[model samples]
Target: MGLLDLFIASTIPVLKVLLITALGTFLALDRVDILREDARKHVNNVVFYVFNPALVASKLAETVTYESIVKLWFMPLNILITFIIGSILGWILVQFTRPPPHIRGLIVGCCAAGNLGNMFLIMIPAVCKEKGSPFGAPDVCQSYGLAYVSFSMAIGAIYLWSYVYNIVRASAAGTTIESTRLITGQSSRESSTAELGSCTEPLLPSKEPLASEHRIDQYALPRTKQIEMEDSGNKQLLSKLLGNINWKTVFAPSTTGAIVGFMIGLIPYIRKILIGGDAPLHVIQDTASLLGDGAIPTLTLILGGNLLKGLEGSGMQKSIIVGIMVARYIALPIIGIFIVKVRLGFIPADPLYQFVLLLQFAVPPAMNMGVITQLFGAGETECSVIMLWAYALASISLTLWSTLFMFLI
Candidate 1:
């Protein structure tokens, strides 16, 4: 295909996203008032808890199989590399930009998580349908592309929930603490007092011990006892670390759906029953697919509604936005190309698959970041601002990168 054809193919999907997003923005206008704050929140909840899980489950069940899983193992590694490298870049950007405490996680998340699912779902098939497309015959390309995209979506959900979700959660907690300090001016003192209050026993021991008292001093121990105490302390430290992790977020609805989908896909008996036209249980799959189809358009609309907030001035620094764009669009794509080229020996030789891998690194941040910021009430407006710019530039950046990626492959 010509460079112009590739550019056109790539740009079309982004343009569709933009148009739907614009409609969302319009619906959120004061006069329209259809997708205002409360409405948006309710819609967001449905998308998060319902539409998203259905999409992930249905798509994975349809595409993933034991053989495909083995063949596509490297794609997961590639996705992980994108997140790792993007996170490193985000951290560097955070240090340089020093955004407000609340937005630090938002910035890091926007950098690390790409629109791995939706963008590819749109772009891959569109590219395949292009005349003289480089990947393969359109029918075969479409089938494999869907599988690749579906697998990418499942893996990306895992990383996004476990890694990015917690980062944003931590940032939200820090922002809350910082805000408390600013308001009360005694947050530290109160924390210390709370800690001290937990130890209610008297500093000086009484002559008579209470009925519940063990009458043994914890501090007075033999050398061996001290070693045991140290081991206990280590266990406590490990427990604290584990407790800090948000298991709920780690096994978020989307992640749960992915796991369930994998089970359905990998177990031949289950797959035979659930996935094909001749399956006895195909109705379940059909229903899930119906719900899944709504995920992207709804997400895009929510994205547009959120972007409306940016118009009111989010107080985010221009430099921070620029940094995120540079990391995701400029720095990450270059790094992805290099990574793919270097690992060519291990990577699947299919140019189409290679294109999907490279594209993962090139797309804008996941639309779910807006949902996340809103969920935690941290930097929602600022997230909108960043997304506005990131997506606005995506049209041009994605076109150029898609052209280059195809040309190189």
Candidate 2:
């Protein structure tokens, strides 16, 4: 397709994709806060066990096929490789910042799961299927599907891993950091004993009692002094780079979903849900169409969240926002070209190979990054900031680059 076709068919519609997701997410966000604590817990339970599962189940049940199964087998490999590189890249970028250990988990996790599933899966196809698309909906969806299914499964794993790591890190820091000097044998009270001189014996009891002479102890400190002290107090910074993780519980749902989905794909009856319409022969196709419907919306929500997070303003210094574009579009395409032209030795660029590049190239920055940042509580200001930058970058850069890469190679 010509550049004009590219812009008309893809870019404009993609913008709409972002708008809808941002609007939906923004609306949904306060649902977490306005609800009572117990209500929030119940909502969380429903979303995770029911809503989220339905979303996943619908996709899996609709779209199982032997071919798709084979394609998915290769999906995790890309995520594993790309995540390693992306995580290291984030770590190196934040190295001088001296973030706490939890921050590390945020960076790595965010980089681990690209927005292929939660956001891009929706945008890519929707954009491609826009009224004027060069390719029809089925063709566009198929192309996008191959890339997203694998990417999403990998993301499921990334979330569980990141979640576990953060929980463990929080617990470890809570236990080991010794914030309470009373328990660790370093209380300031211990130091005051020497200064007490003759009064030491009286003040050193198991519980320090206020003598009548020191009645001021019962009075609250003055407002000005309290405010002054509070203002001057040093805040403990949280370092989230290269964080610790817990693996077992984190990957549970995704592992369950992916394995179940894949297994279902293998069995005809199980795979029928993924496709719709006729039974037996057309069942797989019908189920796939329906379940795949979620691929875009999930990816869209993620991208919109990233965008509204302030990617537009995350200039080069604060986050390598532009660098993300370069990585997803420029760097990745170059890698694809090098591999197809040199590593693979001029083999005809097949649909399978094209699918691989499309998935890799179109995927936004890792989903784990945002979660990772939240986990460590470091980079909170700019953690989502970086993710936003990467998200916006992927919107335009990923689609064009992937399609171009396929054609060029």
Candidate 3:
């Protein structure tokens, strides 16, 4: 199919994906407000360790035949390292501007990691199949995608876990209280010497104290926390970077799942149960396909939601929407081009590598980002706006971007 045709095909799915996702999230929120918060965290844990990583390893195993393992591993390492570099570079650039730390983390994560596995996997392979690449067969697109997705999955999980853990830890520390007064009180009292922290100052005198001998009782007075003190910017950025560094936490489920799955794929004994025969891996393959379809679109809608919410606005809030539009189109893509061309010189203009790079540049901001933000107790409304904008704007951005690259480069 022609490039224009590919654009029409790939982007249309985004709308359905976006809308259903938004609807599901709202429904989920309205039904269970408090429980949803707890559920979201556990869900993140499940996706990171089990559902998501299994999806990656299984997809790779499917694509990585005897001949393709070397490039399968090596080519993706190139993309992973390049993406890391891009993430750091973008981090430094945004840091100088001194935006909120959560916003900074949002940009860094989106720039570094992406929705390639979920969003592009379905679309790009079909496009490649239609075009009939010289690599070997049309399946090269899917194979190529395996490597790309692995790189993304590895880093995306790491980044997400890190981002989330930090915020959660901080939030817990900030809000946790050891005890609260309750009914059937045993009448224990706080030591008078110990000052109780107040969220706000003591109530102002109802009547002006005009009389001599008027007494003001000293009580726990509320003090307004300065914005600077209340600001969690640096803490947010650090949590985003450092929260999930433990090796055991990062790799336990992924490693266990991978080992079991791979053993099933490799061994004749286990293969019988999963696939019914060693000759054909039908059972495992079908199961893999089921996870594959649900994972990406679910993930895409999440991206749409986050992008919808995250963009917030300019400092003054005037022209804020305009600023957001510029950030999505003018700023990010421009930087993406500079990184590909001037910053990191393309070693070779290989079509596959080019496609991978462009795909990274184009993924909309993700819902996972908003999840991370909420977990961290960071800028919610702003994250929501920006994420939504990025998600909503991705179709136009990707279409125009691909068009420009086709003509200009």
| lDDT, candidate 1, 1-409, per-residue tens | 6887767766777777789889999999999999999898889899999998999999999999887888898999999999999999999999998888888999999999999998888888888887768888999999999999999999999999889999999999998987787888777789889989998898787887665676354545688678888999999999999999999999999999999899999999999999889999999999999999999989998898998888787777889999999999999999999999888489878898899999999999999998898889888899989888888899889989998999899
Cα shift from native, residue 240, model 3 (Å): 18
> Which sections of candidate 3 miss by over 4 Å?
1-3, 6-10, 13-16, 19-46, 72-78, 81-107, 129-140, 143-245, 252-289, 301-350, 374-380, 404-409
Look at candidate 3 and tell me the lDDT of residue 303. Answer: 43
Q: Which one is best on lDDT?
A: 1
The best candidate by TM-score is 1
lDDT score for residue 256 of model 3: 48
The stretch of ten residues in a row with the least summed lDDT in candidate 3 is 176-185
Give lDDT: candidate 2, residue 346.
32
User: Candidate 1 deviates by what RMSD?
Assistant: 4.0
List the candidate numbers ranked by TM-score, top first. 1, 2, 3
Q: TM per model?
A: 0.91, 0.61, 0.59
Off by over 4 Å in 1: 186-226
Candidate 2 C-alpha lDDT tens digits along 292-370: 4544454345434544445335333534444444555465546545544464433333544444544553566554344
Candidate closer to the true structure by lDDT (higher is better), 1 or 3: 1
